[model samples]
Target: MMDSNDTPVDVRLSLRVNGQMRQLDVPPNVVLLDALRDRLGLTGTKKGCDHGQCGACTVLVNGEAINSCLALAVVHDGDDITTVEGLAGEADLSPLQAAFLEHDAYQCGYCTPGQLMSATELLSNRKVGTTDAEVAEAMSGNICRCGAYKNILSAIQETRQQHAGAAID
Candidate 1:
C-alpha cells in the first residue's frame, strides 16, 4: 500500500512478546523474524534458510512453535510471541535453557534458539511420544550444522523427564 506521496505505509501491529506488550509499525510484507530482530532488537531468532526449510527462525506464536520467517508480522497482531530471549525469568534461566547448558546442546549456538523454541513446544505437547526416536523425529526440522544432535536430544530428554507430569508453559 502507498500513500498519496507514493511512500509505502507500514502496518501497525500490537503483540505481546515475551510477556511484554510491544508495538511496531512494519511493512505489510515484513516477516515475523525481521520484525523481531530488526524492529524489536530481538536477534536471538536467527535468519538461517529464510525459505523456512530450516527451523532456525522458530518462535512461539500463541504458545505454538512456528517458523517466524514464514509468517507476516501484520497478520499476528495481538498474538503472544516468545523468542529465545524470553525463555528465562527475571534472575534464572528456564528449565529448557538450563538443560541445554547442562548438556552442552550447542556447538556454534547459531541454531540453539530455534532448537530451544521447538523443544519448548514439544515438551508441552502430550501428543508427541517420550522416546528418543520420537523426539528426534519431531525436532528434525531444526538442523544442527555442527552435528550436536546427540547433545541436543539429551538436553530435550532430560528436560522432558523433569517436567514429566507438569505442563510446561
Candidate 2:
C-alpha cells in the first residue's frame, strides 16, 4: 500500500530520449517500458510478451534497439532511448514509415511498433542492404503475429531502393 507523498525523493534518470534529455523519478522495480509509457507517456513502445519472448517492447539504446521490458528503468540511467514514437519529426514520417505505408507492411499493427523499431535500427546501419535474406536475418527477432513478414521485407527493400536512388542523384 504505497501512498502518495511517501518518501518524496526524486530518482534521477539522465537519458536521451528521442534526442532530448530527460530526468525522471521512477520506482526501482519499474521496467523501462513502464516508465516510458506510464511516466513519460511515450506509448509507441508496446508490450506483447512482457518476458521478452516477443520483440514488441523494442526501443533503441544509443542506436541499438533493446527489449525495454527486460531492462529496469534505473539501469538505463544516462543512456539514450528511442521509441517508435521518436522516429518521426516536424510533421513528417520517417522513410521507414513511408515505405511501410506504401507496401502495406503491417496488419492490425499490434506488432508494428516493434517492427518499426527493429527496421529503424537495421536501416540506420550502413551495412544492411536490399537483400531479402539480409532483411530476414535482421528482422528475425521481431515476431509479427499477423505474419506480415513478406510485406515487411518488401517495404524495407523499397526504402533501401529509395535511399540508394537518392544517394546516387
Candidate 3:
C-alpha cells in the first residue's frame, strides 16, 4: 500500500459544517474567516474590524459563538461550524432575521450578521429573557455603531411575544 506517488504534500483537514462534512488543504497562516469566505465561498461571515473588536466575523461553533477572524482554519478540523448562510435554506429566513427586518434592526447592515448571531444565541438561552434591559445587556458584545439598539431590543421583545402566543413575529 505504500506508494510514493500518492504521498500528499499537505494534509487535508475535514470540516463539518451546516450538517455537511467537507475537507480543505489550508496553510497554517490562513485565518478561518478567509478560508471560509475566500476558499470555500461561504461569504455570510463578514469581515468588519478584523481585530476582534467588531463582532462582524461571528460564527457558531457547536452552538457557541466564536469570532471567525481570530480562529485558525487549520486548527478547527472536524468541528461543526455555523455561519450566517447556514442559518436557513434557499429563500426562507430564520426567525431572527425576520424579526430584525420587522423591527428595522439595522441601518447600513454592516454589523447585522454578527448582531444576528449574538441575538440568536441569546434568545435561545432561557436565562436571557425578553426584557429590554436583558436584551440590551445580552447584545452588548456585538457593537452596532448605527445605534440600532432600541430597535434591536424591540425586535427581540417582539420575537419573544411570538413565543408567548401573540402570533406576530
Candidate 4:
C-alpha cells in the first residue's frame, strides 16, 4: 500500500542482531544485508556481488550462514543474526577470529567478514569433515579474490585442532 507520498510503506521488522534486539522499518523489498548495514548501521556485512553468488554478504541467521543479500528483511523477523562484529567478546576475539589473525587468513580483508561467518558455521557443524579438501569445499561459496585460501584453510584447521584438544582435556 502507498503512503501519503504514494510510496510503498515500510514494514517493521524485529531482529535479534548480535545478541541485541533491533527494530527496523524498511521497505518490503529491502534485503537483509541492506537492513543490517544501511538501517542497523552494521556495516561489516559487505555488499559484494549483491547477487547471492559472491557470499560477501554472508551472516549467521539462527546459527546458520546465509547470504544476507538474498534474504528479505521481512522474512527474517525475530531471527537471530550475527554479523562479523558479533563474533568477539568485549576484550578478546573469538577463537576462530584469533586463529584467522594468527594464520593471517585474510588479505585485503574485504571478504574476511563473510569468510569468517562461513567458517564459524562450518566449524560448528559436526557433519563437515576436517580434511582440507572438505573445508575448501565447505567454503567454496565465499570467494576471497586475494586468493588467501591456503591461509584460510590453515586457520580453520588450527582452530579445529585447538577446540578438539580442549574437548579432549
Candidate 2 Cα errors over 4 Å, as ranges: 1-10, 127-130, 164-169
Error (Å) of candidate 3 at residue 160 is 3.8
Give one digit per residue, the lDDT tens place, for model 2 in 15-113.
789988988978678899899988888988999999998899999988998899999998999999999889887899999998899889999999899
Q: Cα deviation in Å at residue 57, candidate 2?
A: 1.0
lDDT, model 2, position 73:
91
Error of 2 at 45 (Å): 0.8
Q: Can you write out model 1's per-residue Cα lDDT over 106-154, one digit (the tens) per residue? A: 9999999999999999988889999999999999999899999999999
Best by lDDT: 1
Q: TM-scores of the models, in the given order?
A: 0.94, 0.87, 0.83, 0.95
Q: Model-by-model lDDT, in order?
A: 0.94, 0.86, 0.81, 0.93
Per-residue CA lDDT of model 3 for 1-169, tens digit only, reads 2238864344478888777898998767788899889988988889998888889989888788888999988789888888888876688888778988989999989888888887767656678766788778877878889989888888877766666563334
Q: Candidate 4's C-alpha lDDT?
A: 0.93
Q: For model 2, give the 10-residue run with minimal summed lDDT.
A: 1-10
Cα-based lDDT at residue 14, candidate 4: 98
Cα RMSD to the true fold for all candidates: 1.9, 3.5, 4.6, 1.4
Error of 1 at 135 (Å): 0.5
